[model samples]
Target: MKRKYNPHGLPPWLRSIRNVCGQFIVPICIFQGIRTLILPSILDVLLLFLLIAAVIAFQFEMI
Candidate 1:
């Protein structure tokens, strides 16, 4: 059987860190996106992609 996921199952410190990251991930994604648009380097694009994925993961509580 598949078990349910619970955010409270996490330790206090880890949960706090996840909360902080969830709050900041959007702005960081925006900044990275703008930076990628202006600069368009390979690394910048890669970073932007990673940041976007992180945003998705955080939003869906898949992290």
Candidate 2:
């Protein structure tokens, strides 16, 4: 059996939200990234950087 391609199965305009999220996330990530690097002695900063890295990695996987 063969499957048919279906765009309607997906929600409408999901790409717009993803685009906005990608745009906003990059700068915040960079700022936090630098801060984390500068303040490695503080555990909170490191954890925040880890979370951002995980998110960016997931975005890479999606792309």
Candidate 3:
């Protein structure tokens, strides 16, 4: 087995935020794909918020 390293060496908190955003976004995408009723009402809204927050965090380097 081989280990890979990131050259930028992101901090632990940034990694955590990225992981959390991925977790939230995946389920929302799956739900949207299924054409669920909640897609527009809830999942879409939640996904939008999560994406906004993730973008801001990355932009400001606050993660």
Candidate 4:
């Protein structure tokens, strides 16, 4: 059987950083999405992709 992951096992500062990233990543992703839609630059698209991946990683606690 696999053991469940515990977030509380992380350091306080790391948890706070994760919390901050969780709070801000959504707005940044939204803004990047709008920018990508409007301008559609390669760099912007790549950045948006990375930001989205980060959001997913955060969601899954894979970061």
Candidate 5:
């Protein structure tokens, strides 16, 4: 008998994390960009920086 092969190889947890990040981070970035264009405030800029840092951390599986 021959063994079957699976095409979808990524683990479930990793796939979920990727989906969540893609769904959440992309929208947050887009919204931040729009907000910055409309009104560039110091607080918003700081928050945007923090958000980008967080995304980078998540991408590296740090958080």
Candidate 6:
């Protein structure tokens, strides 16, 4: 039987490293949009923070 594809959807709560990292992609993209609209210089700092948040999220998910 063919299964439905769910490339972007995840369970409500993060359950794994891939889940956490994957879920973050869209928000990071959206945040970039908002940041660029306000201040281009802030994008770099925002991205750095996103990276740190992503690392922490991944670490928690791994536990």
Per model, state how many residue pairs clash: 0, 0, 0, 0, 0, 0
Q: Candidate 2 or 4, higher TM-score? A: 4
Give the Å error, residue 16, model 4. 0.3
TM-score of 6: 0.38
lDDT accuracy of residue 34 in candidate 4? 98
Q: What is the C-alpha RMSD of each candidate to the true structure, in Å?
A: 1.4, 5.3, 9.9, 2.4, 9.1, 10.2
Candidate 5, 1-63: lDDT as tens digits = 975543246689967886687569857977997898899999889888888887786676555
Model 4: clashing residue pairs? none
Ranking by TM-score: 1, 4, 5, 2, 3, 6
Could you tell me the TM-score of candidate 1?
0.89
Show pairs that collide, candidate 5: none
Q: Report the Cα lDDT for residue 60, model 2.
A: 69
TM-score of each prediction = 0.89, 0.47, 0.39, 0.83, 0.58, 0.38
lDDT of 3 by residue, 1-61 (tens): 9755552588888788776775675555555545544445576667666666766665555
Clashing residue pairs found in predicted model 1: none
Q: Give the TM-score of candidate 2.
A: 0.47
Q: 59, model 2: CA deviation in Å?
A: 6.1
- Candidate lDDT (C-alpha), each: 0.93, 0.66, 0.61, 0.93, 0.75, 0.62
lDDT of 1 by residue, 1-63 (tens): 988888999999999999999999999999999998887999999999999999999988988
- Across 1-63, the per-residue lDDT of candidate 6 in tens digits comes to 986645346655534656656677666767666776677776566785676566665555532
Worst 10 residues of 5 by lDDT: 2-11
Q: Report model 5's TM-score to 2 decimal places.
A: 0.58
* Best candidate, TM-score: 1
